[model samples]
Target: MKYLLKGAGLALLLGTTAAYANDGLMAEIAKPEQWAIPTGDYANTRYSTLDQINRDNVKDLRVAWTFSTGVLRGHEGSPLVIGDIMYVHTPFPNNVMALDLNNDGKILWRYEPQQDPNVIAVMCCDTVNRGLSYADGMIILPQADTTVVALDAQTGEVKWSTKIGDPAIGETLTMATMPVKDKVMVGISGGEYGVRGRVTALNLADGSEAWKAYSTGPDDEMLVDPENTMVLGKPIGADSSLNSWEGDQWKIGGGSIWGWFSYDPDLNLMYYGTGNPSTWNPSQRPGDNKWSMTIMARDVDTGMAKWFYQMTPHDEWDYDGVNENILTNQEIDGVERKLLTHFDRNGLAYTMDRETGELLVAEKFDPAVNWTTGVDMDPNSETYGRPAVVAEYSTAQNGEDENTTGICPAALGTKDMQPAAYSPKTNTFYVPTNHVCMDYEPFRVAYTAGQPYVGATLSMYPAPDSHGGMGNFIAWDNVEGKIKWSLPEQFSVWSGALATAGDIVFYGTLEGYLKAIDADSGEELYKFKTPSGIIGNVMTYQHGGKQYIGILSGVGGWAGIGLAAGLTNPNEGLGAVGGYASLSDYTELGGQLTVFELPGEPAAN
Candidate 1:
């Protein structure tokens, strides 16, 4: 049942009692009738328990209501449904609207921030805000200009606003704020602008600076306890990050954490991955570029590293390690283990022991991936936990100015910022993936402040000799490290996915089709084309005793950048244009929310 708070109870829930607030938010998250957090819950599962619109009836779903954000660009995140109110956010200027579900989606209030337009120039991809976070009766927004603001959920009044990064130096914010305990955590963007990346925590109560941790730098600055922080279950001695880079290159290292965040409350650890290092021309700065392409498990309260796992050391494919980590528990080898499953940009699906940072399963989610032979799984091998790089596709080994062709997954990886969903009922993950490959050539480049520092040029196309399509939506069995079933799409599945207890999985496509499929069979159940292409995540919630599904339809992200930004060059948009150029022929630019539900009277709760 939906838990509606009001008056003194609502006040108590939003009070300064951190424990009570956490408990209250956790309670709300458990309801399944509300989208309290962007990732649905702290685990970032994106799974809903509400099954009112099951596979048997999902075909009858129709549009119940729609709201336009009045802004055009790539919409990367989903709206949050808290109780009777729906909070919607937009890109670039980052306007937020609060809608009352009881009154035909009436606007309760709107909060629009005036951000500098120049900030868009420094953003690597399209200017996309990943949506908002709600906590302690406040809606948290991480603006593109690096300012984080908290607004009153009821009145839409600014509670507190603070600038965390300097846009003049190429630091910006594109991720949604993750509120855990009494802290609101946010990460920086601009990996393509030679900006050093970091994640910062702000006081949830007052927006005051709490703690900051750099992704690449000295151990002290990174808040890494060399003696205590374990990597592959072994202590990483002092200067682990410093010794991995040449000279002071780590200062401009690009380990941006612009993706999603997941937390394990019991372990008190927040999990997130870092992006690739600066200067895609890998030969410029050597060593493993420690921590740049690593998965980090840090104490949520102190922002100190507890464990680390580097996925792609010295990344040469621009394969960012910043994909969302889905935290789940699965039976592996007759033992119930806490598993962290990630569909990495490098075309590998990883299932690791979330508690100890132990590698459990690593396999290619896409057959087209050929950059690595496979991850060395032997514990005794020197390359244990590392990908056995294929010399034929290693851009670094080919050196600068030489094109590395037929690299599967491209710089966009198998998946970009689009998030995958986990269904506990099926023990399967529904992933939105790209089936594209690239020809990458690295070249020397000089970094100028707030200017693009990308040192590589790439052109992408569909994975040859395959489906000839650009994307796939697949059901993955993490326990087996394999795809249970796969569904091909004409373009990359750039939108996030949602799995429901109803045995239905939903994801959007670059052609604006919001599709529902059978969770077990991967059979397409229903599809509705929205006003524009969908790069936004799919979300669900129940209101007035009725279940509803929602998605933001816009056409600008890395994949849709060619159309969204009016760029016609095939090489533009960081090689995304070449692969997704046809997207414009299918859908145009739009910024609106299309909500779907069954046509009938309110169902009994």
Candidate 2:
């Protein structure tokens, strides 16, 4: 019945939300009938009400076929298999392609936007696109230039393109993840240089700016300012954010929107996590910094602000609140209610009122750092460690490697590979995380659009016990606000998780092994290897009776740095971050799209 209701909601969404009803572009894309991407439909449930591939036979899974994508930079985008066709976007501009899933590795059509190669130089992350969004009959893509481009779903042709940012202004549009409609929400990156952050929604069909929201406001608008930025709670003159800097950091304040975005279509609302504040040094931006390190909920159509809850106030650990929010319903205190849950970078799992953005619970998901006693919502906002987390960062010239101060979750937790996916079968959300801490010291530097993120140095340390480590997969019950079960990984699992009807949860590890686990009890059921490492999104679909599982195997992503550095650590042997985790010790720069199905015959991709 819940599954049927979800389908009905998608069916209704197909016809309603006619605000951009021109060209029927969004109307014919098929009812929001399937879990097309990461958010699992327009709303980010992470839970699919379907259970075709239950626990019993999930162990029997095998490879179907492999499609080689010769060009590999960072494979983060999940393949969107719509009907018999699969649409995918690769790194850089104009790399979108449409492949036929009817036969293994068949190229139906490939469309490249052919934008200037210069744009690739501007991307903060390794030229990656999370995935393409489909609605009506068109596919929506955020190009390297921060422009939203619509592609014809069947032909893989561009329908329209709207520039979202000015690259010249140090503002670049590298949509880290796919955009969810209602909010058409997109986040900014370039945080290393103090670029201001924003997420905007445009009319889906016409690509017109519906509304725009900012992460950092004026001095009076600044929520957390160490300097006297405001006069009686209002904006005063002299923007100290500009004191040490050059370029737009003083203006935008580097609250990069580069996080996962999810939506709740039925409620006509969307949620997105915000990135860390600019210039890792806490003393610079002083106040709680408004929307940065926060989660925002807004109406999908009007793009009006609904509610926002800050995860970390005046965060100094470079911990961005940019993680996925799972929309689930659970009975709390005997009352069943709609709720949104997130395991934030602040080492906490939060359950909030989906419609009104109320923080019902903000429980520590990690015990490594207790920078704050707890969250308080009286007037409604976050209050950090009694006197605020001390970010005592000193200079190297003064002779120091940025003396480390222990901070929980290191620069990697709450949940990294898209964070905790929910499975309706067990009513649980599964997440992969890095359980570690770091002593981060600050260093001052000039702001450059395409340079490294300076201003704070990080010295990391492992957890004293096993509860937290470089990697963890935890099953959390939304109603309880607690961990149901957890399994540790050898390395940080950076791939987005997928829930299949196969009665299992599938996720890729950094070193290339895609593992399946019993959704009920944290039992390892199956695993396989890809070309390199799997740091992207893993998805599953069924066509022609055979169910299929697919994801990328690339090692150039964030995890590769440590994996590479670990390789040179003679003390650690040849085993790298994800080494020996079922993946062979090999460096295959080329990434291929591999799918697994029942041995012998190939399934429709």
TM-score of each: 0.96, 0.82
**Where does candidate 2 stray beyond 4 Å?**
1-35, 176-183, 218-250, 376-402, 448-453, 467-469, 561-588, 600-605
> Please, what are the lDDT tens digits per residue for candidate 1 over residues 1-605?
11121111000112233353376577667777899899888888898888999999999999998999999989989999888999999998999999999998899999978877988888778889999999888899999999999999999999999999999989989998898888899999988888888999999889998999999989999999989999998999999999999999998989999999988876778999999999899998899998898899999889989999999999999999999999886665456667788999999999888899988888999999999989988888888899999999999999999999999879999998799998877878899999999999999999788888899999999999999899999998776778899999999899999999999999999999999999989989999999999999999998888899999999898988888899888889998887787787899999999999999887665
Per-model lDDT: 0.89, 0.61
lDDT of 2 at 498: 75
Candidate 2 lDDT, 193-311, residue by residue in tens: 56777777676667777767666664333332433323212232344333333344446467777667765546766678778777666655556565567777756565555565667
**How well does candidate 1 match the true structure in TM-score terms?**
0.96
Cα error, residue 25 of model 2, in Å, equals 10
Query: How far does residue 182 in candidate 2 sit from its true spot (Å)?
Result: 7.8
For candidate 2, which ten residues in a row score worst on lDDT? 1-10
